[model samples]
Target chain A: MDSIFAIPLISAIVSIAGNLAVFRKASFLIAGVAHSALAGVALAIFLASISIELDYFLVATLFAIFFALLATTFSKFSDIDTGIGVSFALAMAIAVILISLTRGYTAKLWAFLFGELFLMTEKDFLYISIALVAILLIFGFFYDKLIFFLFDPEGAEASGINTRLIDAIVVAIVAIAVVAVIRAVGAILAYSIFVAPSAVAKKFSKSVAQSLIYSFLITLICLILGLIVSSAIPISASAISAFIASIIYLLVAIEKS
Target chain B: MAIEAKDLSYSYGKTIALENLSFKIDDGEIIAILGPNGAGKTTLLKCILGLLRANGEISVLGRDPRKDKKVLNMISYVPQRSSLSIDLPIKVLDVLKMTCKEIDSEILRHLELENKLDLLFRELSGGFQQRVLIARALMKRPKVLLLDEPFNGVDVLSQKRIVEVLERSGATTLVVVHNINPVLHAVHRVMLLNKKLVAFGKANEVFRRENMVKVYGAEIPLVVCEEGVVHPLYGDQHG
Candidate 1:
């Protein structure tokens, strides 16, 4: 029952925040940070067995933020994609090592790997809701400035917009959003929902507001439809949702071409 | 002086982009900066705008652009059209909205962009895109305006409109152009640069064969029109 409500809610939040990331050209950066978040989660689980207490969400958020800053620093001297690729690889390796070091949490960790929506408790939903609210507030307050920066960075800087600060804030927000949703949908499916809707919306909409609306609607529809289809045919909801999103993107590409 | 630079210099690691350059512009004068690719034309503009930190002193409107960010309220910049993200889903109106709280419809009508407000920026032709950029700059009612490669990819008609707008702007304008023939008549003076200040004076006085050779490393053919205006015949060398 909670899965029914949680999937659509999380999807809505990811679409809006994800589309903003798309505008900033930080989609892959989100992926890299999301992977780093996994290492943080695994480390927390491993530490708990040694009788050391650390909040997994706090550690994951910190790890993702660190990866975000690292990727940004790497991007300064090289292509952004290359920086993100390196961060992604390093984080994945660390996560595997940490997972190997842990014991008797295989079932719990596996649920995080592919996302078990049915396992979400009320507390999980509340935490994600707080993240959604934070994303909305930050984006809403800085919408015009962010749009100006994304449109023309040099112009924004000349206008005294503090573009570097804006860049840092944007990547940090994406990092937070990725960490919040990674466990709910897993890394792979999180990326699909984060990018696919915005990519499709960019083709269909003529304005930023229109694009945001379209992206949100597309994600919500995919999540709800995935749920309905999974109920009839015993399939994983996250897999079905991601598959539907990909199919929509492919169809959009073919039609546009 | 609307802008002044004293021995301004900048280097990117080992490569010196600008070297010991000093010049000044009177208020409301339209000066065109001419230089070949990598001649530090854009870098000079960035220095004046305080986007890049330089070794020497620079001032705009009696304020150090790097030290006093309040100067930004009285200045505007229109970067090259190519610098913009080509696929953003932003409308002409959206770009204007970012500049100020209210859109000056008068500026829109002047640029002939009022009707095109609903169109996405990427959907517009190159000419219209340049106009929109200029229009966005003008909306701030700046005391100083800097434009980089405004003529690139623009049609002849849009170029004319751009010149007209700049003429009426009454701001201290510094425009960087590759082919100065199009804007030669509109500019009050020409500041030729090739990593260093080559010449800064009236176009006729500055376009001497030696000046052309010194900056461009070649003898650029010069033509004198009926009005005795000197026009340098050279292909556009934008990068």
Candidate 2:
């Protein structure tokens, strides 16, 4: 594979793994975290304008994890539905967008929102690689436990699985993976890549392991296809990737029906 | 005792689910927890399993269930069939593999699920789903097995098969059921509850007319059939 394909390959790996781990378990929350990450990106930009240097990926990951945790806690403790957390995320996203405009960081904001896949720096590649490795390692170590937890939480808890801790770890891993790939597939379109392939794979998979493998393959195919089409035409790569993912999902769904 | 609870109480906000519930189960004893819809049968099981916080004390295998993680390894719980989603693309074997540390082929054979291992859980009938859940729990060879509504959608033949398997396994079993007539012969003890311990004794002692009326708050038609005792309010069965 060419060095040019390395970044998107890593992004696809992380997207599929994170989506399988988190999206299947907490679908709405992943979308909420993806949108809420915009607030973190805005904050990082605002800090940079004030002559402070920080890792925007780390900042965005922390913010997304915080929002995810907040939502999980509220849903677990209070009578409020988990979807209520999505409203908070949307509110934060809008607030940060307005703040970014006021600070004259509109161009930077658009890059984070729509993504500039071709502009991925060497550092972005390194960060995504580390995230991919970390995600794979965690999943490898806790594959059975995670599957048990996701399949039957009550049964897992009864069997001494520490489901609450597992849930938090899953959310954090997803948050980091989503933030790490934001440069390759923007905050706005990240959820599409994260969920679509996994959802499609699940339609035909008979086991968790098979579902994961199918998810990775589907995501890689969509990424490669999107990159090829966008290179030929004057279209956004991330947008095309998102479109391909949705098309694949629809095709699978139609076949199933 | 395999399981013990003292002054156990749990409430959801202002609505009390269980109040001052106390019980003890000897090792290898099969006990059925009989109660109405909202009598906190599930709540009691959750408390014992440490899934829900409750006031007072609960000990499983001589350790506080809330403090010791090892207790869980020795306990197998089958939640209500409705609490699980069969639509997920999970095979019956996949569920067993994820849950049991060591699968017992004999238990699977007893439940007649050995042949259905490759089937998707969603494709099984309700009775077969319950059998799969039971098979998973039995595969663990747990010291204590807790089942909530194990026979809700189960048919008569499957129910008999399940009771026979449980009776032979000799695990300290606590089963929560709305009706007790099916497993009356298999159970060593019967616990009647209505937000509190109403009756705790043998099936004949707890299944009396007064205790039934007190627990159910209405007249429940009961009869002595060939199967032992039958609660006609739930269903009819032949032994």
TM-score of chain A of each: 0.94, 0.89
lDDT of 1 by residue, A48-102 (tens): 8788989777888888888778887888889888888888788789889888888
| Model 2 CA RMSD to the hidden true structure, in angstroms | 2.9
lDDT of 1 at A1: 76
Best-performing candidate as measured by lDDT: 1
Worst 10 residues of 2 chain B by lDDT: B230-239
Model 1 chain A: weakest 10-residue lDDT segment is A110-119
Report per-prediction Cα RMSD to one decimal.
Answer: 2.1, 2.9
Q: Interface Cα RMSD per model, in Å? A: 0.9, 1.8
Q: In model 1 chain B, which range of ten residues has the least summed lDDT?
A: B230-239
Question: On residues B68-165, what C-alpha lDDT tens digit does candidate 2 reach at each position?
Answer: 77878888999887766456678889888777657788888888988998998878998888988999998888889999989998999889889989
In candidate 2, which residue pairs clash? none
